[model samples]
Structures are given as C-alpha cells and as structure tokens.
Target: MEEKKVRIHLEKHYWPDEIRARRKRNLGRILALVGLVLTFVFGWVVGSTFATGEPVEETTDFAKLEAIYQIMSEDWYFGKDVLELQTKLIDDAINGMVDGGGDIHTSYLTSEEAKQFNDSLNMGFVGIGVQYYDSNGTYIIERVFRGSPAERAGVLPGDIIFKVNGAEVTGIGSDELAAKVKGENGSIVEIDFLREGVTVSKKITRAPINNTAYGEMIDAETALLEIYTFGDTTGNEVMDILDDFETKGAKRLILDLRDNGGGYLSTLETIGSFFVEKGGILIQQEFINGTTDTSKSSGFVTVDWEKIVILVNGNTASASEVLVAALDENLGEKVTVVGTLTYGKGTVQTQRPFSDQSILKYTIAQWLTPSGKKIDGIGITPDVVVELPAIMENGFEPLEEGETIAPDSVHVAIVSLQEALSFLGYDVDRQDGYYSPKSVEEFKKYQATYGTTVDGVLTQEWISRLHADVARVWHEE
Candidate 1:
C-alpha cells in the first residue's frame, strides 16, 4: 500500500518569515505589472459614476498588461489556464489596488465566495454552526453559535478537528472543511475531534441557523441584547427585542456588540432610528472627490431605557461603530460605551456584483460620526477601558500532574488561572484564589479544548495558550 503524506498548513499569521517574504515579492511583481491599468480603470469608473464635470486624461497603456499576460501564458515555468489566469489577473489587480491603500475592509470576492458572504447576511445556512480557523497545524474551532449543533455536540473554542466523515482533514484548508461540514438541511455529518488528547466522534445534523440578533433579560430591569451582525432582518429582530424588553419591564439595556464584524449599511440606519432623533445624521460619508452624504436616522425611538451601556471590543467595527457613535452622541449621558477600544473601521464599502456573479467590494467613502469624529486607524476609545492583566510569577514552575494545589496547599497563581478560564468561556465559577475540585474540572475542560493532557495540572504551554487566547478573544471581539 502507498503511504499518504500528512501535510500541515498554517495560516498566513503563522507563516514563516521566508514564506511571507517570498509571497510579498511575488505580490510586488504582480502589482508592479498591473498597477497603472488598475489605477486608470478605477479612476475612469469613478468619473463615469459620479460625473465630476471635468475631463480626465487617459495615461494607462494596455500594451504592458498584454505583455505580462503573454509572458505568463507562454514563458511561465508551469502549465497555465489562460481563462483562469485572466480572471486571476483582473481579481488580483483590483485586490492589489484596494489592499495597497491599506484599507483591509475593502475586498474582492469570487462568485462562490461572494455568494457565501451574501448568504451570511441573507438569513442562515445549513451547517453545524461552528466557525473554524487554521492555526499552527490544525483546524481550531473559533466559535460555536448559541444553540447550534456544534454547541450541542460540546464543541468549544480551541478544539482541534482531526477528520470529517471518516476522512482525514488535517491537510485540508478551513474553507474546504467548512464546505464539507455544510450540507442539505437535516443531513448528518460525522466529525472527529481531539480534545484533552482524547479522540471524540460526533454526528451532528445540519440545520438552519437564524439567531442573528437575540436578547434576554439579565435581571428585572436589565436586558442584554446581543447583535451578532447587522443584516437584512437585523432591524426587525432588534425591534422585536425592544418590544420584548418593554414587555419585560427592562428599563436598563446592555447592548453587546462584542465580536460583531458588522454588515449592511442600510441595516445600520434602520436600527439607529430606534434611538437617534428623527432625520438626524447617523453617519457622514465623505467621498474621494470632496463630496459628502449623510445617512439619517428615522427618529422612531421605540423602547425607552433610562440607562444603556454598550459592551464593545476590538471586533466591533464598521456599522457597529456607527451605531455606537450615533447612540453615544445623540443620547448623551444616557449611553455609555464599555470594554476595550473598538476595531477602528470608518470606511463604507459598496459591493457591486459583476456579470460573472463575482463581487467587488470597494471603499467608496470614509464615514464620520454625527459629532464629526473620524474612527479610521485610531479606534474609538471606550468610556470605561476594561482589561484583564496577566499576573504570573516570572520563575514559577507550572504545576505538573499529581502535584496538587489543593485547599490546604494554596497558590495565588490558581486565582489568576481561574480568572483566565472564566474569561475564555470556561465554567470556572469565581476567582476565589483556591484550587478546588470545580477548578480542576474547568481546568480539565480547557485542557481538552486545547488537546492537552487531561491531568488537571496546568502546564507552561497551557498558561501561554490561555494568555494568547484571551488576547485573541479580545482582539476578535
């Protein structure tokens, strides 16, 4: 029997320096070849759309583009598909133009990828509802949607997936894995995962996930409204939640926008109207030609809340930032922003689908708050900056197996570890500065999620990973 190679692929973030540098070199060559053409085309398109009333010169020479394509087709070291190569050339040119400007939010999506992106905002898909990312050498689960099959199957953040449907997937990319995991509604798929060094198998049935926006009363007068992303139906969902809050007599509201990467611009306006005054500017859009437009709120304040606190983090971006700023500026003292700095994103992108079904999401305008605050590279500083400081002994050795730090034998490090676990969504009740059986159980769960030895003993690697995951959660939040 022939042996198969087990290939380990790391994400770009974990790529070696040489590999990244080589990629940059290749990218530079492609950019250099197509830079002029892209610039000319972009300018011409913009002029045609807006009609600046001034004549623009045509300086781009198409000969260079033809020459590069010819060289790649004939003299390239490998066999090439001219059609695919042309598509790639056009896509790369647009991507380079957008990326070169340092606007990470603007992107170019292929036909299939664009459909997936649109599907995320349309409603939901038939899948296990776990978001995974490629890490060091495995596909690590990043998030499990609430009430999802993955969550029901006990999938947790940091759990490493080993196989799908009896096929080894260690060498597959995250996108391919996602496609494999998703199926027709009511279909079943098998998953093998490594948790706490134990191989666990699960059979999860695919179903529609529609909990994009949801809320619950945290207390008699406090409600926690979590908006995962602003989408087509987000306004209606939020309105329904507000009605529910009114019915529940919840006067205090906590808007949780943590980990929300934002969605539709029209949805922002619709949602903003609930709090902002009627016909007030929600966000100002400034174009490249010194022109500006404003998206105004409908001024239909529905639910009345005396106190409102918005919980945001680095992942709160774009439309999320717009909503936060609108509420804070319009409502004044009634609204307060809590958490770390937001994920500074101030540009509004316009997605234009081409004839081939591909989509080009290009930055068309820079957004500003109603109060004229620009939140681009510099994120919006929270009114209350909350952070968990990592307190660890410089030379303290990690607790090994069988080396217990029980109630009688106390260790201050235990409290810090407990706090970390609690922040990472582990069931570590409270940071009582004691290593109890509860702590041991949660510690084991963390170990399982990270595929570490389930000895209930914290290792140096575990501590390091805990710190890193904490940072990751905050940044991705």
Candidate 2:
C-alpha cells in the first residue's frame, strides 16, 4: 500500500506560558466538539467498513487501491491539469483523515468530502439529531430531536461518541463529520457512544431534520425565540413573528437571542432592515479589494423600531450580534437591551465551490456598524447588564458549592431597583424599602415609555436602569 504524507503550516509566532495552559484546557473541549459535528461522518465510514455490513471477505484493498491510483497517476493523463492534481491530492488526504479516526464521531474529509459533508447539513439527515459547534470543534447530538431514529435508538443528549464500529472518531471536523454520518434515506448506520459514562452501541436510520426556531407566546408579550442559525429563511421567520406580535397587540417585544451562532449574513441584513428605517446603515461590510459598503435598512418596512428589546447573553453570536447591535444603535430611544455581553462575531464569510464534490467557505471580511463600531472579538455590551442567577431565586433548585446567592440579595436588589427607577426619570416614591403596586405601576409607566413588556414585573431591567448613570433630563439636554 502507498503511504500518504501531509504538510501542516503554522503561523510564525512565539507562544506564552498562559497561552499554552489555555490551549491545554481547550484541547478537551475541542475534541468533545469533534465528537459531535464529525460523529456522523465517522459513524458512516466505520459502520460501512465494519459494523456487520456484508462482512468483508478481505480486510482491506489498500494494495489494489494503490495499484489503481498509480495507473491513474501515471497513465490517465488529462495532460497534467493542475486542477486534476489538487483533486487527487485532496482525495488522498481526506481518506487518510477518516482512516486515522480514534472515535466514531471523528473523521476527516478531503476538500470534496468536506463539501459534501457540509452541504448535507441543509439537505437531509435524521435520528434524534442535534448539531452544535465551538472554537474547540464541531459537535452533534446535544439533544436528540424527539421521535428521531437516534432518539428511538435510546440516544440521549450529551452522549459522547468515542468510536464507531471499532474506529476511533475523536477530533473530527464538523464538515467532515457531517459528511460521514449522512446517507441516502432508508440507510442504516451503527453508532457507538457513551451515555452517563456507559458505553453503548446502536443502529439508527437517518431521517430529515425538521427544525423550527420560533416559539410563540401565550399570555405574555415575550416570545422565546431560539434561532439555531441565521439561514435564508431566518429573516422571514423573524418577520412572521413580528407580524404575529403586532396582530396580537404586542407593544413590547423581548427578542431572546441566547446561544444562537451566526449563519447567513443576508439573513441578518434582511432582519435588520425590518427594524431600522430605510436609507440608514445597518452594517458596514468590506469587500475583498478593501472597498467598504454599508447595508442599510430600506425602511422600517416590517416592525416598529421602538418596540423591540433584544435579550442577549454570552452565547449570542454572529447574526445574533448583528441584529442586537443594529437595534441598540438605531432604536436607542425605544429599545432597552438586557442580559450579558454578546459573543462578538462581526466577520463575513462566503462559500466557494471548488469541484463538483468539494467547496470552501472562509471568512472574507470583518464588519462594523454605521457608527464605525467593531464587534469582532470584543462583544457587544448590553444596555442593562444582569448577572445570571447564581442560585435559584426561590431557593428550590439543586444547590452546589459556590452557588447560592447571599442573604443580602433581597435588600440589595430592592434598593437598587428603587435607585434605578429614579435614575431613569421615574416619579416613584423615594427609596421605599418595599415594592408596592404604586412602585410597580411607576416602573410600568417608565417601561411603557421605552416599550418594554409591561407585565408590571420588577425585572432586572428596571433594577439596572435604576443603577445606571442617568442621562441629562430632556429639557436640559
């Protein structure tokens, strides 16, 4: 058998001790991610080759394959096409990655394989399937979709795949891994994974993934929307939600953009256009030649600008950040953003097809807003910041070390809320230790002014505004 070798390029730089330590910690997380995104790809390769599939009469045909490849390389000449050279090279490289798997969830694809693998994400697949990614690597099956083949096969969320049909699939990429697991409908794949620290093997059929990101509100004006990514349909979904809200007399909106990573930039641009008025910048996009252009809203052609209050957190990234930043900048008077700093991702990426089977999607440019604000590494700050609940506020959830909020919380929160209301120009009674309907009503009135959901609940937003540095009074300004 002919052996293949790979060359890895490294950027020239000296690493610090802290960076090394951080990398060490990041390694496990990254591998775990590989276990998810690449899990399917690894599973297919291992299962097809192993997993009781028309049992192989002979273990492998690498020798025969090598002979065939040698003949193609030497005889089958399209006259030394450089394109042909790269194709052959990429094919060898991908096969090597798949064969090097340590777990069923990890597999490598050649550029072509990677393209087929990634495109499959939008095409077809099934099982109690879930997909996720991180800086560490790509992941899958955080939560199995209900009624999926994987779910019926007893696969639970967070079940880590260490192998598939005896092939170790650790550290595989998302594009590659997705390619591995996805097959034509009615195809069967065997997956070996660890659940609750116990190793298990299961055969599951693949199915199409039907995902929805919008969750409707019942009694409250706040609808919990969990966008997995900003795809081509994302803008339409958002617009539909806004239409629903307006139809139901929703004067205030809380856009929950937690844990959503970015996808299509066009979706963000479209969504931003719905909220911002026309002829104004929504985002500043730079072209490859260094020419910068701004994506502006055609107008407030969809929803009212002042009615949205985008809720963000550490996991909110990419398209989510774009929407949040746009609303924050354009609807400052109407929007009262709350939650933690966002996952700042202001870069643009485009996918370019190589061959019939492979494609490459790489980041092209970093983005800025019309105001020239950068959101790349430095995340967007919330207008009002509220720390996550250290422990259950009602003291009911499981308690662990370093979890519980101190006893001084209630007094502190009440005092802060009172102070914040005053700072935001609420005419509430002075510094009252108690929360009465009067206080609540006064907070509601202030919220009404800024278009927050007027449930009359003394939320952290109200408390935050109390603690904020007051802007000058309208008359004075």
Candidate 3:
C-alpha cells in the first residue's frame, strides 16, 4: 500500500442566505423516504403556540431535575462550561422525552442536525455520491448512486473506504466520515479505497448530487419506478416519470419502495392523489385529543390503466406506508404488494424549530388507511411475499487449513454460502444443499482474487465479505 496525501479545496466564503434559499427552491429538496419531510397537516403552521388553561400536574418532581442540573453545573468532579452543559442538558431532556417513550420516529435534532435535515430536503449535496456503513472495522460502500461522481470514478459497492483525503478512517464514526466526504460543490475530495485487497485512489470532484426518483421501461409492457425519496419536487418527478412510462408504452408498473424510509407527508399526499380517485380518503389521522382528521385525495388522477406491483421491505415506512395503503385501498385489485412487510410507522410527526434553531420532531397523530386499518407495530403484510434469503454473517465455522469439504458434505451453512456466492454472480453450478467440487473451485477462485487464503476453505472474514458482496450487488442491481 502506498501512502498518499490528499488535500480538499474549500470555498473561502459561504453562499448568501438568499442565494442558498434560492438554490434550495430551485433544487427539489426531498428524498423518497429517507430524508425527513414536514407533515402535510402541520407544515403550514409556523411558530404555533398554545395557551395553557391550567397548570398540568407534574409527572415527575422538577426538583430532582434541578438538583441534577445543579450538581452537573457546580458540584461535578470536573469543571464544565455552563452554556455547553446547558445545551447537553437540553438535548438529553429532549431525548429522554422522546426516546425514553420508546417511539423511534420521534426525535430531537440539534442545530447542526436540523441544518443537515433541511439540507437533505434540498435533494442535492456536495459529496462523492455513495452511502456507506461502518462494518466491524472497515468502512464498506453500501451503495453508489447512478451517474454519481463516485460511480463515474469507478467506485463500486462492497469496496472498503480505507482513506478519505489520504487519512485513514478505519474506525471513524459514520457522521464524522460523512462530514469529511461532503464539501462545497466543485470541491475535490480524494478517496483511497480497497477493492478486493487492491488499493485504489480517485480524485473525485464533489458536486451537486441529485437524489432523484428513477423510472425506466423494463420492457415494452413493464416499467420500473424506483422512488429514492419523496422531496419537494417528487410529485412532479413522479408525474414526469409516469409520462415517460406512458411514452414508452408501459402498461404494467413495478413501484420499488424497498428500503425507502419514508419522506414528506405533503409529497406522499401529492403522489397518492395521482393513483387514488378524486376526493378519496388518503389517510385518517387521530390526534391525541381524541379528535381525528381525514385527508382526502386532491381528486387529481394523472395516469390511467393497468396493474401495479409495489415492492416493499422492512425498511419501507411512514409516508411510504401512506402511499402503499392509499393505492391498495383505492385501486384494490389493480395494485398488488410484494416483498417483506413494512417498517410499520403509523404515527405522523410534526417538526418545530426552537429559538436556538434546534428542532423537535414529536408524534402528533396516528395514520390509518381508508378502510380504517391501523398499521403501527403490525406492518402491512404483502399479498405476495418474497423474503430475502438471509446472509450468514461470517458463516458457522471456518474450514480450517488441510480440511476440504467434499461434495458429500451436507452442512446447512455451506448451502447458504453457495446460494450467496451464486447470487453475487459467481458460477456455482447448482445450489443443491451440498458443497460440490464446482462450488469449492469457485470459492477458491474468489478467495484468490480477493487475496483471501486460497486453501479452498471458509473463514469468518471470508463469509462476512461474501455477505457484503451479495448485499451490495442485490442493492445496486
């Protein structure tokens, strides 16, 4: 491995607020479902306030909280800045309120977090377009967006991001690594990575990356629409995609919502209006006060004709659920859901920014389908279930040196390993629940190519790599 020094060029001045705002307006600020978006019901309410009729009974004694704050501020073993302590206290308090309640969707966002959340809505960011995860000790590329600078630069899935700007980030936290990769548009960020034990470096120009929805005709009669996330412009984006689908003569559509975490409620409603009938109920929201509100479709039906199949996985949630439920309820036999069950987030969140710009995303109401089905903890079951095969994390046991499993071996783990290998494009002749000679040969070739021990045996590291490779290809394709 060669040591390389890479310097990132930074902009000298920040864009004016007006210019930034204009850029945001120009860019469709929304992800399909991963990025947070304002709720449709409360998005219009800014700086809302409530007048208390009476002092509510305190659930917990305030004196205990005060004592803790006093002890931390004054009597702690180490001295701390009052402002910093105050900020931490506020953050913890908010966390306790939401997180402690066991509602994963409700969250507190600090000023920085709030900024990032808002930035994601812009649908554009300056970075080498890749989403990664920190595995045991390596930073593995989970996804490389199509046409991204990273993709254009030959960044591939399952590649280990060993260094950013020549600095080793072996054990770096995800947030810190993200900050390192993101910069002003047009800036350069050098990335050094390990692709199958080979060190590769690329000088990537950070540019405005769009989180766009994808739609392409898979065949003359079938089209695939992959919704990345619902953002400000997603409704229009979807409409444009449908137009293209129509132009290409696609009659059957596959709506891929797998891994979509849910996005803007407004975007959901807008998109739902296209598939649902005019004046149809999109979702029913029940507030904490026992009052409920029913959101109806805008009565605008855009595309007409044929069958639709919605693909959902465990990560499909929130607004995505809304869209799925709406179309399922309204279209009935026209829509069929496939894949695993969804994330099952039935609650809607309202975001409010405080004076200090910190944001609080608290649950306001529970959303129900038009038929009055509540899908909170219990997710919407698919009509056609296609559960993904589980990837063995570093297989059951490493095949030690000098020990070769012949075709007679009937271990269940080997069967799983063979399946994974085949899924990742390896030519494993047949996955017949046995470790055949061809399987061993293919495994040895894979090991040799990736610099693994070429002993034609499995190890923990080898299995983990196999799992990652399969996942990468599964997701990317």
What C-alpha lDDT do the candidate models reach, one value each? Answer: 0.69, 0.53, 0.69
TM-scores for all predictions: 0.69, 0.49, 0.73
Q: TM-score winner among the candidates? A: 3
lDDT of 1 at 169: 85
RMSD after CA superposition, every candidate: 12.8, 19.2, 13.3
**Per-residue lDDT tens digits of candidate 1, residues 167-206?**
9886576567878999999999999976545677999999
**Poorest stretch of ten by lDDT in candidate 1:** 7-16
Whichever of 2 and 3 has more lDDT, that candidate is 3
- Candidate 1 wrong stretches, greater than 4 Å: 1-36, 39-60, 67-100, 195-200, 389-477
Q: Estimate the lDDT of model 1.
A: 0.69
**What ranking of all candidate models by TM-score puts the best one first?**
3, 1, 2
Report the candidate with higher TM-score, 1 versus 2: 1
Any runs in candidate 2 off by more than 4 Å, and if so which? Answer: 1-124, 132-206, 210-212, 218-220, 287-290, 305-307, 388-477
Task: Give the per-residue lDDT of model 2 (tens digit) for 1-477.
Answer: 885432111100111110211111112222222322211121234434323323223333543334444544665445276445534443443434433343222233335444334333232344336543221231324445434677678765545555654665645764456556666677777777643334678887877664435646655555444555565466676778777776765655667776566656666777778778887678887767989977788774654533666777787776677777787787777887788887676666554443332333344666887788887779888878987532111111212323322222334344445555655567767454466556667766765765557765554323323222221121122
Per-residue lDDT tens digits of candidate 3, residues 362-391?
677888998889998788899998866644
